[model samples]
Target chain A: MEISDTELMLLGLVAEMPRHGYELEQVIVHRAMREWTAIGFSSIYFLLGKLQKRGLIRAYTSRASNRTKAQIPGADSQISDQESEPNTKPRKVFTVSKKGMRILKNQALRSLREISAHYSSLTRGLLQWPFLSREEALAALQDRLEALRSEEDRLSGLQLDQQPLPDYENAMYDFALSQIESEYEWVKRTAEYMETKPWN
Target chain B: MEISDTELMLLGLVAEMPRHGYELEQVIVHRAMREWTAIGFSSIYFLLGKLQKRGLIRAYTSRASNRTKAQIPGADSQISDQESEPNTKPRKVFTVSKKGMRILKNQALRSLREISAHYSSLTRGLLQWPFLSREEALAALQDRLEALRSEEDRLSGLQLDQQPLPDYENAMYDFALSQIESEYEWVKRTAEYMETKPWN
Candidate 1:
């Protein structure tokens, strides 16, 4: 069973630890998931609802959140003491259900088995290069090579904040780094092939 | 001037040889354009209409096509021949306009120059692998390695048919080959990494 990309990301994050929708939103934004996957802040709630209805995740109230909220100060002296009240925070954090784990495992298996392709419009344009001059094609491919390297740098520079990077994250980083480097090498090769393969 | 994948293909094919819709459809199917690009049989006419309206292509009569239609075996022979009289075929053969060539050239430059990422689902899934078990992940990676090799073989064995493969086609094949081989190596490296990387 194939889950949507957003669902997969959400479940993956939740399985790491129970997270509120807002926290999940922040994590996705920080990681720039929107650029890669078909997801946005607005769609987060709707997908959670759908996932919950399907029993992929369950909502839990977090007392830890309530304690954190209660730590806020209320002015000075008697004013603070007399006015203190229960912070009453019932943050609805979500944790992945067993079904979600099964889905994630299956999705991973399918993705790994699926054949990769250059299915972008850019590749499409490259495939049908009839009118493009060799000079223009060379320039364009060079520009792509430059861009790929910059992306490689960006991925390599990614930080996991103050926490030690998890093994899975290292794996993910390694996977992404390998792909970017592979594509960088590919664009360079394409340029060489284009130079020899004339369209006249 | 970002042409849709179908439009790019249609223009490229029409530019190759003035062809009717059926001929274009057959070429796309034979080339497996739909597998790599977002195109379908149903959208063929719709894209043709859009392209024609945009002055990227224009319909014209071809006496050669008319002759071909006339050669079709008549189920009603003499009666059809008498009715055929002038054999007024309304075939809408299309050829690329000057503007279409310009668009194709420009689209190629833009696609090559633009940065590429997550254009495929595999990249997105790899970005966020958290909950999956190491055992399952290793198994999946191994399976992917097998699939990638067979795909590599399929691409390597692609026959250029009676015609010598066009320069542009060779570039496309080489580009595809490099990517698959790159991925095959990447997965093997990843499986090795997974074996060493602990999930604690």
Candidate 2:
């Protein structure tokens, strides 16, 4: 089964430990996973429900009225599922099944091995160079250079704020920063080259 | 006005010169534009019609029966309308309007100036490294290395096939190839680092 990036992250988190929807949101925020994946706070429950429907995960809630709620030893006490109001919904804790774990492993490996193309809009703009005058083109590239610098600063700030990261997380941050820096250098060089070349 | 990458490309192409749907498809294929922008051949007419409706472009057909058909002097002879059958539809030749030209210029500049985030799924996989075993991780990276090499070969081959390109097109191609090469180097270094370090 092809899982989305958000699904993979959520499934991996659950595989790490049984977690409720709120707990998953905390882990995502704590790790700044939003920088890499699109996981809206509102969509967490929706995604969990989808995963449960797929049999990749099983949910256990501490409500006797809910038919799908599975009974676990001391589950009601552990979760502190206080149904203070009649309208209060049952909070379910999700755990990955064996099938989910197998799929996660396979998908992770497939993701690593694949070389998906990253298309940039700038390439399209460059292809349509005739649309913009030479002055406009140079100014746009200059503006891009400034934006790249600000982006570098912003990313660095984010990394600093999320300090004492795991070795793997640190490596990911480094890779991202390296990519932006590389692009910055490319734009600078391209701008200089464009300045010297005659407009076609 | 927000325009998609494909729309921008198509609009810019029209601004360069009035072209029929079939001609636009040919230009896209001959230039290998599908690698950068998602412009399917079937969507050309749909998008053109949308642009016309939005008043960013106007279409001229050489049919007298068609009310929307415009009369460009000698357009029938120029386009060879050839409406022998009662069911035959007149081929539309789309041209960018003055307003279209202004918007296209602004959009092209904005596209150049903006630095949109390019999220990679590999980053997500790397973040969830805890799910994969050490051997599995190394093997995946190795497979990725091989894939990157093949990708490099393929991109190089494509560039070679489209020889004697314009300077701007050459620059765009170089930027793309450079990005892949940089990623390959990063992956190689990362794999080596992972080899020596203890897996978490």
Candidate 3:
């Protein structure tokens, strides 16, 4: 079964542990997962719903969570008789089913093993280089270098904030940095060429 | 005006010269543009229609093309009296209008100057590394290395085929190859770490 990258990412998170939508959002934010995945807060609930429909994940209110809730003053008063129905509840914690775990493992393995090309608008712009005047093209390339530097700084700041990262997380950050540096080098070289080379 | 990368690419091509749908497809294929953009043959006409509605491109039957068609035996007999109606013609060539050129230039410059994050599923899989056993993870990394090698070969071959490429086109290919190589290095390092590091 083909699953979208976003779906697989959500499944992997749920497989790690039972988490409420808010907790999922927190984890995503704390880890800066947005750098690598285009997931929004609203999509977390939507994806969770989809995962539940697919039998990949199921929602449940753990006894511990319920007990903690009960400890809060007047919490018991707000509890509905149909406590089993988690769909209507505002804070439904989700756990991956056995099927969900299986799918997650399969999808993760497939993703790790496969390589796919990403389309960048930079390529489109580069291919149409002749369309822009020399001055405009040079200015654009200079701006790109500045943007890349800002990106590098942002990524470095994120990496520093998450200290004591697991080896894998550290490696991920390094990988991202390396990509930026590579692009930066290419842009610098291209800019020099654009400056010195004759234009039509 | 904001245009999709695909729209900008098509507009750039039309700006290069008046071309029919088939000719655009040929140019795309010949230049291996698919590596940089996700455009399908069917979407060419769909996008063309959209560009026309936006007044960025206008279709015309150039006299040169029509004259060539008239040179064919029996072609004049097939010509309708309402020759001005290009919509009914099989080969209506599209050219970028003044507005289209202006918009294309602005969009291309913006694209060149901007940097945006692209979400990769591999990051998701890496973050959830604990989900897989050592054996499975190691095997997946091995497969990734192999996949990267194959991609490198394919890109190298494509680069070779497009000899005498413009400086910009050559740089684009180099940028792509550098990204792959960077990832290849990261994957190799990651795989080694995964192999040697103690697992929880």
| Residues B167-194 of candidate 3: C-alpha lDDT, one tens digit per residue | 8888888888888888888889878877
Model 3: per-residue Cα lDDT over A55-78, one tens digit each: 999998745554555466665445
Model 3 Cα displacement at B179 (Å)?
Answer: 1.0
TM-score of each: 0.81, 0.86, 0.87
Identify the runs in model 2 with alpha carbons over 4 angstroms from their true place. A63-88, B63-88
Clash pairs, model 2 backbone: none
Better of 2 and 3 by TM-score: 3
Ranking by DockQ: 3, 2, 1
Off by over 4 Å in 1: A34-36, A59-93, A120-122, A159-164, A193-199, B60-89, B119-130, B159-163
Predicted candidate 1, C-alpha RMSD: 4.6
Candidate 3 has which clashing residue pairs, if any? Answer: none
Clashes of each: 0, 0, 0
Top-TM-score candidate index: 3
Writing each residue's lDDT as its tens digit, candidate 1 over B99-141 gives: 9988877876777787655544555556555555677667777
Q: Which scores higher on DockQ, 1 or 2?
A: 2
The sequence of per-residue lDDT tens digits that candidate 2 reaches over residues A31-137 is 78888887899999999988889989999984544433324455574343354334246768899999999988988888888877788867877877887899999
